[model samples]
Target: MTTTQDFPAMSGSLQEPAPFWRRRTGTVVTSAALVAALFGGVTGGVVGALNASGGGVAAVSSPVALNASSTSDVSTIAAKVLPSVVQVNVRSGQGEGLGSGVVLTPDGRILTNNHVVAGAQQVTVTLSDGRTVDAAVLGADASSDLAVVQASGVSGLTPAKFGDSDRVKIGDQVVAIGSPEGLQGTVTSGIVSALDRTVTVPGTSTGRRDSSVSYQAIQTDASINPGNSGGPLVNAAGEVVGINSAIYSPASDGGQAGSVGIGFAIPSDQVQQIVNRLS
Candidate 1:
């Protein structure tokens, strides 16, 4: 029996500027020069956007000299948060898919992307320690692209700490945890490349109401890919600040494809609202 979860307000908007490195230049400059320009501009935009959001540009500090103590570490973070991160598998009569999710409550409430389990006949959640459990839809919001699911007979589930995304600054280190390409419990690290980036996600409905959702995301070069959707983007303090969403892979023929050291994650502040509604 196929079940459909209704995701209200599950879309978002896009706000990154046109990558400047692809522009044409004077006769003297070669194609290589264009590529260099593009790389520089994209990188600069990432940093600039963060600065702009954080108020103003500050002096660049040396990475070596910065040593702020935090309760988050690889072993500690993994042990504490891994059980919360789950593998979401959706199966319909005609198709099947796999994605990532996080346990938001001890009583089986889980958080994931609405699109992940939108039209599944059955949904299964796999834990980090290899426990698979059947899951039911709690509520979904399409405009926000967020969903909440519930599992029965699940115990000892650890919920993740939600961080204030608005307090994040440029150059802040971040960690992404999820199942990329079906590989569960994968972890990647990178800096908060940008913030307040608006991306347009295609709306669920058609016709006049077929508008897009504007999302202010946290941009990073953390190697997020297919199957990583809905995973948590954690801060140095091991708090989740964003949810891994989309990648800007232009077409190869004068376009972009794959990770070119650029990736995006939805801000946790926005996600918290949807999660709260489900709770």
Candidate 2:
């Protein structure tokens, strides 16, 4: 039996998936562990959706100005995409946890994993300019593992350019950006190893045993870890194609699950649809 466990949620629940599909030959494993990439020790506080607009993603900034011939340039892509990504910090009754978010609109609306801000009492985000600002949860959907948060009174922010996930092909170069282990502005690069991978992760709410979220994921080899949840996985054109969500870990890793070159992301096309519903 293949074993899959979600990265540590704030509650540290051990979630298992339905069944494992054998795609690679000679890759025999008795169990597969899928862990939530969001932090575990720090739980988020609960918040209601404040007044937010369901405005579509803005085409602000020039984050897609890479050379057409070379979409795999990490340095160029990182510099352009970094500003649109932010570090999300949550404080709750249990403790404080940190994750990552992608800016959706210029007026401070952000997109991140629902688990990142789930159960959070207070939420704040640090922009790439090193400015930290208070934010509020606009809405969260545990079913889709997506959420929308808005930074208070913020403007002139750079929104990420979302790409067409449907057009993402296997082996295409991609970049992952987020704060892992509280290290903000971290960047990692890899290729899209697979597509339409089914990933199921537990919700962030406490005391709900049946609370879980499942979605078809874009699998990549990027180095994703705890606190990298909700960060953007962009294509070579600096377009956000997916949101880094979960990773596969060997059962023997002893709970110290880091990226093993098999990370999964929520496709950006789904992200845009959910953000619209939440916002």
Q: Give the Cα-based TM-score of candidate 1 against the true structure.
A: 0.70
Model 2 lDDT per residue over 145-251, tens place: 77899998899999999988888877787767887766788877777777886565544443122354667777777677667778888877788888876665543
| Model 1 Cα lDDT, one tens digit per residue, 72-141 | 5555655656667887776543244566787788877888766556555677888878888999878877
Q: Looking at model 2, report the run of 10 residues with the lowest lDDT sum.
A: 54-63
At residue 184, candidate 1 shows an lDDT of: 81
Q: Report the Cα RMSD per candidate.
A: 13.1, 11.7
State the C-alpha lDDT per candidate. 0.53, 0.63
Weakest ten-residue segment in model 1 by summed lDDT: 57-66
Candidate 2, superposed: residue stretches over 4 Å from native: 1-37, 40-72, 206-209
